[model samples]
Target chain A: MEANSSPLHRGPLIAAGILLGAGLGGFVDGIVLHQILQWHNMLSGKLPPNNLIDAKVNMYWDGVFHAAVWVMTALGLRLLWAVGHRRDVPWSGRTFFGSLLIGWGLFNVIEGIIDHEILGLHHVYEYTIRHLPADLAFLGFGLLLLLAGWALVRAGRTDTTPAAASH
Target chain B: MLKLLATLALLLAATTAQACAVCRPRVEAAIHAPDYTDTLLLLLLPVALLVGGVLLLFFSPTLFSWKPTPPRSTVAP
Candidate 1:
């Protein structure tokens, strides 16, 4: 087959999109769940923030968590800049956005399982005694995003448009 | 001129940035905990897993393609 007929390489683009999505997902959890709602903290499961000192301690740890996610976001942007320079990767918005969704879903699923279920580090809603429902809901939402993203990405495979660098 | 002076003053006051006098004791005590390492690792686990998987994905996309619906132009010129 001719080079023109070969499949377009999309790994770099997909990877960049996923990294960005996961980083954004982390921010959402940190901001909405941890700060705005006052639901839980990084070590709330292990050390409940019941008092002023303990709450301040948890806040400090939360800052650490935020710093890590910021790094992830920065890395994703750098990768995207590199991917734009390549000629092989197709420029499909569907593929990129789908990848973002997949990344977010993966973050939610992995974090929910490890942090909320196995390790008991924290819960989705720690204010209540029953945390199972909230945890399951989080996982379920992740699964839904994963499936939807997979479908979009699969559809994007048929697009023949090349990236700007190739043009 | 005022902003510059204020910034310099703030930099000089870095030593007192830990916490207010009231919470200084608690903050100082918490800062020296041995369990911080454990907590740090536990917290970073998920991010590590995701980052590793994404890096791998960058190299693996060339291995396969959807044969049923190939791209219209396939290779970019």
Candidate 2:
């Protein structure tokens, strides 16, 4: 293909989408699970946070996790800005949105496996004695997200307009 | 090399150095615990996943060999 007519690079956009999605997904997990539901804190598994001091420690770790995700989100935004200016990146809503879903799904899968299963860090709903059910459900949700994201990305394959031209 | 060694020595001394009664146990546990590596890994898991996922997505074109299709006209014929 001619240089001008060459296909846009989807890497940056995909990177942006995944990072933003993971960051936002992490926020949801932190807010909903840690704060609202009180299902688990960052160090709940190790320290249990039954008392004020332990809870404070867990809260500190939670803040750290949130800070890390915030950095990830900011980096994603930076990548999005860079990709938007590039003539080789396609300005497809489908691609961007699809990648976002993929990123979120990837987050759930990776986090769920590492923290929930491998590390025994915490569960989605920790009230019950049998935490496996809740963990399985969380993984199931992740699988659904992955399927939906994959479908959207496949659909986005048809979109070919350069981002610069779209604007 | 001397600076690096000095820094390492300082770090080692800091961990063993006296602290308040309240903080001493926690600090000692963190340093001397048999499972310190496990604790560190657990702490790093989420950050690793976030970074790794982003990198994977960034290089997805090469991994998946994505090809650009021709743009479709929006206007109806």
Candidate 3:
């Protein structure tokens, strides 16, 4: 691929993919837990209840918070794919991996800050001793995504350069 | 094959194990009586967006990159 192939084509496609994937993936939380499993609300068992009216409002905002999570998952997948696809392009592995890690961190941090903290939608630890396994499973999934994304970006960097790469 | 086998084993183990009282009831309820109205709509919203995103990512072609499919004649030959 020529330098003229400039990685410019990546922007909107990647952005759109990330936003969509994150949104959809985040929706899985609400669907599987709240609606399906009926285990509890995503933010439930964590926050103290105010009143019946406030509880309903909290649930409503909880849905919105989950929507934001879905959006972030979209961004994660987009970064992974966009960076992985640029192996043949002139992009460096450092750039790709760095971008992906930063992107994932930013997603978590921003969601944590705005949606969870500021909005008072939920907390980081929303589980009892019995539900520890479930909480850990979700956390593990997140870590795996970040790791896999980083690996792809790192692999792309190495393969793109003739000096570091044999093939 | 190994991954599938491992997954199957895990599934088997999970099934055989005594269920957590609270967890079991919830899971069973979800399977037997899914409230589709409010939940289904919310679930589909994200899924629809994802499908659209994937299509744009892999299939959409630009002016230079576009591969035109053969146009069919209105009348059959």
Candidate 4:
């Protein structure tokens, strides 16, 4: 293909988008569920943080989770930097933001399925007897985010202008 | 750097030496716990999927190779 005709290298953009989204999404889970809501910890179901030692163990696991997400965010930043100068990559805000939502949605769905359902780890709101509804609702919201993100990314496909060139 | 290393070594030694009877079993239980590998995998599944999906999306342009529209001619009518 001719140089001008070559399609954009969307790999970097997509990578950056998803990683950033997942990282931020992970933060939301850590903060809202683990902290504010006091619903659960990383290992609450398996080893409820009832006593000091068990609590310490849960805290340790939570730290591990946070560390993993921090690394993901860093990786996303690196990918964004790598694609910053490339002319072929469209620097559309919609694509990036959309990817973020998708990433977050993906996190919620995956976490909801594996942790809440499959592993029986913890529910979104653990205080009530009927926790399944809350968990399902969380997954539903994640689905909504995925749809919105997908739409935004599709919209971004028409934006072919180089970001730097426009500035 | 040397002081930091010494301090770290001391901390490690102190922690090992100071393991109380009550703490030892809990620590041992945590370390020797069965089925934790499965738990770890479950936790990691979503992260792996997100990373995989993103990579797939990134490389999709190459796999599909959708043709770009030709640039408009600069000449005016």
Which one wins on TM-score? 1
* DockQ-best of 1 and 3: 1
Which 10-residue window of candidate 1 chain B scores lowest in summed lDDT?
B62-71
TM-score of 2: 0.76
Output the worst ten-in-a-row residue range by lDDT, candidate 3 chain A.
A158-167
Question: lDDT scores for all predictions?
Answer: 0.82, 0.73, 0.45, 0.75
lDDT of 2: 0.73
Displacement of residue A103 (Cα, Å) in model 3 is 7.4
- The residue ranges of model 3 lying beyond 4 angstroms of the native Cα positions read A1-13, A38-55, A66-121, A124-137, A155-167, B1-77
Q: Candidate 2 clashing pairs?
A: none
C-alpha-based local distance difference test score of model 3: 0.45
Of candidates 4 and 1, the better by DockQ: 1
TM-score of each: 0.83, 0.76, 0.38, 0.78
The worst-scoring run of ten residues by lDDT in candidate 4 chain A lies at A1-10
Specify the poorest-scoring 10-residue window by lDDT in model 1 chain A: A1-10
Q: Answer with 1 or 2, whichever has the higher lDDT.
A: 1
For residues A1-167, could you state the per-residue lDDT of candidate 2 as single tens digits? 24245645777777788888878888888888889977767667676766655666667667777888888888888889887887777677877888788777887888788888888876666656788888888788888887887788778766666676778
Better of 3 and 4 by lDDT: 4
Deviation in angstroms for A42 in model 3? 6.0
Query: Sorted by lDDT, highest first, which candidate order results?
Result: 1, 4, 2, 3
Instruction: Quote the lDDT for B2 in model 4.
Output: 100
Say which docking band candidate 2 falls in.
incorrect
Pairs that collide, model 4: A11-B58
